[model samples]
Target: MVRLRVLFASCWCFVAAASFSQGDTSLIRAAVLEQWVRALSHDSMQGRMSGSSGAQKAALWIATAFRQIKLKPLSPKKSMILPATVETGRLRVRINNVVGVIPGTDPSAPAVYFTAHYDHVGVGSAFSESFPKFAPFHKKTDKDSIFNGANDNASGIAGLLSLARYFFSAPRLPNTLVFAAFDGEEFDNLGSSAYVGQQEPGKVKLVLNLEMLGRARMDSSLGHFPIVTYSRDDKWVIDSLNKYYRIAFGDTSRTKYFLPDPYPERQLYERSDNYIFALEGIPANGIMMTNDQDLYYHHPADEWQTLDYGLMELVLRRIALTVYQWLKASGGS
Candidate 1:
């Protein structure tokens, strides 16, 4: 782990220096990010619980973003919503995954995916009803309860929308780029599981799932860096990222904003959409900034105001740079 951190640090230095000289001026706007997060995390969205009206609304909003970006739908249909039925115990619920694509110059090239789960645990069920663990922190109130999940995933979805816009503006790409906003992730990872199972064989090159990117971990003094978690054998993912950073910045070193997952024991790598793809032997990974012990995690307090828009803007810009260059290096137009 120490060795990997050192490698990443050295590469980041190279990329940073190169970026300054190369004039990579495209930056993620703070207002754009804040708007998306606020819309998704608003009270009317009802925590965006899968199968609920609010979730459907959120899915439609994402589809609108894709349409505005001019991303082609993955299927023959013009619509971006892929609906599925998820079973929980004896109950059945409908969910949707908003999927879009940018066809690559090379038809046979393995596609790269950018994914983020758009669902969250809903409101009303509190300590006395479902989650006893939350009883100590939350107080019973006359007001209605809702878990807005601004950081838990709204921020990730915001990032996905901005990335779609960023890549759509590019002239050419190497390989096909698939953007998936998954639903029902909070309920046993059903959305991503179904999507992965239905894909054509050998079509996936890599999966980069985004989650909880709004706030930095309070435990770290340098808090804003993201944790990039990949499977044990998927070191090539890092190498490819480094390759892109070098190509974009005209530098020989890797990028610095990512660090290996620090709390592997938490099993965070297997806890998101990328895990399903990784299970199928694809080079899958997730980038996020979440700590289970975070005071606001899953609580009603995880609202838009609690988010750090400045940090989100910086992170989104870094992600856009890396992804755009990665596509070029991997054969994207």
Candidate 2:
């Protein structure tokens, strides 16, 4: 194990020297990212289906990480997890949204949010489709269905937590920052919908949602730059991203990729948690490694082992840096 660690570090050094003259590859920890993804995606969480005991457990784990990172809870109750009820079809269940806040030095400043959902479709039922035959990774008569959502959103959770920890311990920014782990997103973005419904329009300056930050498409290599979709009217968000990204990395050759939803007619913008904020006239955007076309999406086959730690680290570090620069440029001291 020691030798492997040494070899890994050496390889990273070689790669860094070869490619990133201006990038800071050491800003984020690969081991920490790996640990979060592994624990969240473990079968013990039972796919982290919304409103299930498994989802509750996952919420607890996220709250613990927030506390350990020293982020103050945003709720008036002094709690990190906010409870909610979600109804899909005829089924209704209670769930949680884990929230942490860093009130800016200037409390009057606009707030910026970072969000990710930690829920997935639950296991198959007795009358549901055939087990392993239908799902390809399940058993013939498996009593408990495990749709361990590794890439679907576990990777997003890891990114959220890591960013919280990174910013909490660093120099204070000017604008307030909120980190949220939403529940019941799979059930029509219920978690985020509730959050946006309660907030006053324009109370938030920006919303940066992270989802499926794990794997790329089968034809693409791991960490192949993911998509960053923004609100139609929010050109400032994209401009800030590209501007600060260049400022932070000193790499003008590769601009931060931000695009409007190419298929607005498809309502693709409304598909994720960010949509709720967008509907409320708040400038919102999100990061996604892949869309619904990915083969492992929502499949039991999505596991921690399938992700590339090197890519995860790089992408997450870039996100942290880019966000920092954006907030700083927005007047975060």
Candidate 3:
């Protein structure tokens, strides 16, 4: 009996050590976040507006990141491009959703998907000259000028890429993983709508959408938490996550964050690409830092310099770890 007790004690110690190591792995440094944000928000990308050359360049960058991570292509053509189109009032333009997949350990296992819209509000309307408040940032009296949506979404794209890198390097994923950088999300979520329309909706078990994570800030009351929004049907999923994860925000137990408030529902959930998937009855949601009340939202002031890189890193790491744990617990394969 004494020998058996000693054996059990040793095993317990090993388990404790392993748990510590796993927590430690959740660290994402500010340096990495800075590099990614800089690249995506660079002026050369011309703000990554939909139907623009900059948007296409951003897509290429995303595809390259997938290749570097060694994720397999999901398309039958073994390519990252999922052909799509967008209608901009009078003009219809063709775009592609950059897609890649990490095959499941068990071929029959259900799939978990990750998505981020790589498009943003392009230059403002020509009426900007009449409304000084709506004037373009980089220039004066310019119509259809660049919005350079650095924090609006470039940050989210970086989070997706970082998460992809983590999963690929660890090579520990059990369930099939699908990573998509969608186009035309800025124009009424057309990209995600297209994706959901094309796929067998029932096959997707969960979706983690990244949006505006770069500018995460600690609210006076909430501490350092990232804003995580989900469909009403995903209450169980959110509860499970809140139970396991340590987030930047304080008092996460407060129902105000997850439940309906006096605020408009569409203002909170309807603006993102995840809404499209959720509408299709898939468990889909998005992570972002903006309270939707941030002063810099969609403004020229929303530049890389204004972002909190350290906080953003923490937010991204938490998201990646949450995804890892979810996949593990769900028997991802």
lDDT of each residue in 1-333, candidate 1, tens digit only: 999999999999998876543224353677888999999999999888888888999999999988887888886754688887867666577989999998888887888899999988777663223435445434532264887889989999998887777776665566788999999887768889877766543677778898888887444664436545545568677666656656665666433556677778888888888888888888888888766667787678889899888877877776777777776555532
Question: Which of the two candidates, 1 or 2, achieves a greater lDDT against the reference?
Answer: 1
Model 2: weakest 10-residue lDDT segment is 125-134
lDDT of 2: 0.75
**How does residue 223 of candidate 1 score in lDDT?**
49
**In every candidate, how many clashes are there?**
9, 1, 8
Tens digits of lDDT, candidate 2, 1-333: 999999999999998675443234354677888899999999989888787788999999999988887889874665888887766566676879898997788777888899999987656541123122234444432553677888879999998988887787556777789998999887789888776655443467889898887775432432346455645677677777777777877876664454455556756567889888888787888777666667777677778888877777877887787787677767743
| TM-score leader | 1
lDDT of 1: 0.77
lDDT, each prediction: 0.77, 0.75, 0.69
RMSD of 3: 5.7
- Model 1 residue 104 CA deviation (Å) reads 0.9
Better-scoring candidate (TM-score), 1 or 2 = 1
Instruction: By lDDT, rank the candidates, best first.
Output: 1, 2, 3
Model 3, 31-108: lDDT tens digits are 776787788777777777667788888889888878887877885665887777766566576777888887778766
Screening candidate 3 with a backbone cut-off below 3 angstroms (N, C-alpha, C), the clashing residue pairs are 123-145, 175-332, 175-333, 222-250, 224-248, 224-249, 225-248, 225-249
